[model samples]
Target chain A: AQRVTQPEKLLSVFKGAPVELKCNYSYSGSPELFWYVQYSRQRLQLLLRHISRESIKGFTADLNKGETSFHLKKPFAQEEDSAMYYCALKKAGSARQLTFGSGTQLTVLP
Target chain B: NAGVTQTPKFRVLKTGQSMTLLCAQDMNHEYMYWYRQDPGMGLRLIHYSVGEGTTAKGEVPDGYNVSRLKKQNFLLGLESAAPSQTSVYFCASSLRGTSGVAGELFFGEGSRLTVL
Candidate 1:
């Protein structure tokens, strides 16, 4: 039984300020984590993944195995960054299905 | 390339009525998935298919059914519509093989469904 949790349902940040969306997961085996973003009037897309270790749109997330967390972070917020962010987890060798979190609605205020 | 396309972008149905949502991918992906997005609940996997003619239950599979008769098409069916089933549905596809396990998923614009 694996689960992903995004504690904050909504988060607001001023333009140019740093932003952090918290995410935690409960999985005993090794896990692959990813952050998916949905922009206004757009389809959901992958923002970043722990395995790739590459940042997209200036956002990055580090997987913390000890704490069972994979929080998404950005150095500075922009109005265009406002969207729904979901944290997902995939078990190492399961059915290749991802378990998603409740999601965080990030609003970057200008 | 019309990466992933879902037909009937918007649909309204009455309780007890049934309908099917169609998803087609042109990328030749061997894996397809159906998910429902609700406010605050994020996107929950309803069902998924590993390849043609193979389907499996996902996180929230109780109220929905799915089929993957064709390699490029995955269909989600609702036997009886209910208000609780109203949500935005998304279809996604990914490659298969060693790189498929943790590959990125390409998604469709999504289908909005409302059960009255």
Candidate 2:
């Protein structure tokens, strides 16, 4: 069975501090992973994908194949970066479907 | 463009009541999906449609039915509402891609439903 797990329910950090949101997955075949963010009163949107390997809003997630982990990280946390973040994985097929993990609510304190 | 839109942004229903949530995407995407958002569960797939008439059960599909009569629309129906079914539903769409190439899923604003 393919599963995505985001261990943290809530993560608190102060502004200018480093941040890390852990995500792990279980899949037999090679998997595709992505991070989605939901801001206040906003729709859940794509933040970054492991494929691109490019940082978005100063956030980066590297897919660790050996550990099946794709942890999201930021050098300096910003207050505005606080929001609900979800990790998702796609099953391979003609009609791809996403399997999302429990979200992490990051609250950047002043 | 309203990329993806869900109707009835807010709803309240009693137990055993039935309701349908509609999701429409204007991106001409071939894939549409329905998911439920809970406090800690993030989002769980309920159902998905590949094209105009093809539908498939997702990770969690009990007590829910989906229809894709039109190319750009996918509808999720709850035959009988339950307290457990009370959640925020989200609809998403994505373009066709294979294996590792499939990128992001565009999501809607979400529809909050409460079952009393």
Candidate 3:
């Protein structure tokens, strides 16, 4: 069994401040991690995957094997960045199945 | 392109009533999934299909059933509605599953179901 945990239920930050959404995972085998976002009145979309090692909308996440963590970070928060974010994990050889975390609602205030 | 579309955007059902949520994808995906979202639980997979004729149970498949008679369509059925079944259902699809690659999911707008 695999599990993904997003510790924070809600995170609020002032515009231009740095923000981080913490995620942890428990999986026996090597795992694939991803971050997904859902904006108000919009469908959930993929923000980025760990393997991509690329930033999207100024947000980046680094998967740490030793600590079993994948934290999403943004250098400077923007108002438009406010949204619900989910951290998900897929065990190796598990097909396309994904186990999602409870999610964190990020609010960027002006 | 209507990547993934779920029918009956919103529905209300009483106890013992039956309903089926239809999901269709036009992206020619090989994998489709049905998940229910609650206030704090995020998304729990109810059922999934890897291809046209095969369906598999997911984490929360006890109260639901699924069918995948066609490659592009996956249907989720609730034989008897329960209060606990009220939730926002999401349909998603991905091209294919490889060993190390976690295929990104394309999701539908979602279907809100209320059981009274």
Largest DockQ belongs to which candidate?
A: 3
Candidate 1 pairs with clashing backbones:
none
- Candidate 2 stretches with Cα past 4 Å from truth are B98-101
Lowest-scoring 10 consecutive residues by lDDT in candidate 2 chain B?
A: B95-104
Instruction: Give the TM-scores of the predictions, in the order they appear.
Output: 0.96, 0.96, 0.98
Write the residue-wise lDDT of candidate 3 on B42-105 in tens digits: 9999999989999999999988999999999999999999999999999999978464446789
Residue B89 lDDT (model 1)? 96
Query: Candidate 2 has which clashing residue pairs, if any?
Result: none
As for TM-score, the candidate ahead, 1 or 2, is 1
- Off-target runs (Cα >4 Å) in candidate 1 are none
Of 1 and 3, which scores higher on DockQ? 3
User: True contacts preserved, each candidate?
Assistant: 0.73, 0.87, 0.76
lDDT of 1 by residue, A3-110 (tens): 999999999999999999999999999998999998999989988889988888899999999999999999999999999999998888666688889999999999
Q: Tell me which of candidates 1 and 2 scores higher on lDDT.
A: 1
Candidate 2 C-alpha lDDT tens digits along A7-106: 9999999999999999999999988889999999998988998878889999999999999999999999999999999998876553668888999999
TM-score of model 3's chain A: 0.98
Judging by TM-score, tell me the better candidate of 2 and 3: 3
Q: Give the candidate number with the greatest lDDT.
A: 3
Report the C-alpha displacement of residue A65, candidate 2, in angstroms: 0.8
Candidate 3: pairs in clash: none
